[model samples]
Target: MKRGILLIAAMTANVLLSAARADEAAVRAEIVARLPESVGNIAITPDNQLIFSHHPFFSPEIRVAKLTSPTTFQPFPSAEWNTPRKGTYQYLDNVLGLRSDENGVVWIIDMGFRTNITPKLVGWNTRSDRLERIYYMPDPVTRTGSQPQDIVIDQKHRKFYIADENIGPGGDGSHAAIIIIDMDTGRARRVLDGDRSTIPEDLPITVDGKDLTVSAKDGKPSIIKVGCDGITMDVRSEWVYFAPLSGRSIYRVRVADLNDEKLTPPELSAKVERYSDKPNNGGLSIDYAGNLYLTAVESKLVGVIGADRKYSTYLSDAEMVWSDGITASADGYMYVSASQISAAAMFHGGKGENKAPYLIYRFKPLAAGYVSR
Candidate 1:
């Protein structure tokens, strides 16, 4: 009789475990906002306000914007900040990556690709509705084709890690690396330049049965390869995770080693660990439990690499054309943007195929997440 009871208990436990797994796999993405312009990235202020960048690939009139309603938005910070003034670096030129810290300060990375000026990081205090700071990234720190796309803010250590995907004019993923900024001193350094882990793997990114290609300077067709695109820091700020947009793996290094100026390039490179295999991804975020969330651009889905280093699909939708940027919100949900980059005119041979009403989606996460991370 005892043996039979034990068998029944085991069966009940198995059924409960299976049900929990099924519930987790059933998480669905719900549309939070729809806009006429494609969204480049997404961030949420402490007060739960949605802020996003208008994808620069299409040369948007408004560089950054904040949601006024579910379907409407206005230029963020101000309209003047989005307008380009000749010979001045005060306005936002081209912006992509942005994130809001716990204090409600939204840090924006302006590529400066439009006017060919110095790239910079701009911080706007959402609470005060004022400009907080601006850090210039000049020649040596940024290269000829340096497009600093994504940023990871480590407030605990007063540092900012930026992923520079050298896909600009003279950049062809050859000069890709991480730019470490010391928030305290306003100093920056380019580390792991040309490292294998930071560069793209020789792979083609295909979308909707077509390989994405770009025209070279000589009018030759070449695969569009991007490097060091996605970047995120753990809740503890111990490690910064990053991966190339055209590569199939994620890599990370200790924040301590990256901040140690005494460490040589080779030494820093040696410290990088191949975290997990992933699809070609665009953005990254993390939960407090250490699970890394990735915007799997190629698959039209959001995937999570758990603390155990296993990757699994978290949420998927047919409308998620190019899941560009993702962030963990204070509301216990993860938000992502579908930029529809594959339908852009440049990829479709100069005839913009993207439909209006690009989407921003949110779904519950496995664990609670930090807003600053």
Candidate 2:
């Protein structure tokens, strides 16, 4: 009887010990940079460097910096893309999403629609400091024009899933969908075409807690606008997830179903899955451990949802305003960019000033244990 009681006591002690350690290691934060210019999205390159897309909507250059020493950032040359051969692709209209993978290649989603339908996807070799490859996710309607806004790559498979925002004039929100491209072949195909799963719901916008009305078209004022803005993927399950910028819900669809181009429209739409509710989120990224993280723009908070479906506020603080870009780093940290996009003058008829500025921040997370409430 004494031995049995001792065994039970030992088991109980182990459980308590594990729980205690987790509680001690929840999550930690450190501010990386504060800049006046806008940085829509951030991607940590395989070489352990940081690259961000600059704003002004029509900025011609993309900036690259080393985060090894976060406080001291020096710009690396981007002339590689400016060569005469690269031409028009060299200028950056708006860089919305950035990502890299095990392949050591850096991928950038340049939504050329900074003014119109100039959407494009480009890549670079961080190690060589050279432009690697580029692709135009052809429009599903014209099947010839470029159309893309965000990207989530499966490096192991060399496939990149591109989100088609389709925000051009005279365009319908129906074009919001996913595009899959095999890096090996440069071949691309439209997936989830006109699928309801990827359309934006026009979730009412509120600034300073007040409802704000904005038009989808740049010069024209109108309503009923829809476009997918953020996207990420679960490579293990071959699930590609995306969300509309003005929508309240996130959506997903299987890679296999999307890749089967042979399927008809109604047949493919059936594979679409309405994923989850990630209100006011501007971007998304999945960590190495299968946790999907989202930047809750209006809340100034970042959220993480594990494979178990348990949602947790990974990190939250007054510093996280208009959370724009989010990407996981290698050194036990997740990086975020507070672009304060909502604070942009254009977002609110230039009434709102960018007084809060913008910031890039990161935090180390406690993987398996609870650190705090």
Ten contiguous residues with the weakest lDDT in model 2 = 364-373
Worst 10 residues of 1 by lDDT: 14-23
lDDT of 2: 0.61
Instruction: Give Cα distance to truth, residue 165, candidate 2, Å.
Output: 1.9
Clash totals for all candidate models: 0, 4
lDDT of 1 by residue, 119-227 (tens): 9999999999998899989988899889998998998899999999999878989889999888888899999888988999888889977889888778998888999
**What pairs collide in candidate 1?**
none
- lDDT tens digits, residue span 266-291, model 2: 88877777666666566777643445
Which residue runs does candidate 2 get wrong by more than 4 Å?
Answer: 1-28, 56-93, 114-118, 138-147, 168-172, 215-226, 235-237, 308-312, 347-349, 366-373
Candidate with maximal lDDT: 1
Q: Model 1, clash count? A: 0
RMSD of each: 6.6, 7.4
Give the per-residue Cα lDDT of candidate 1 at 10: 42
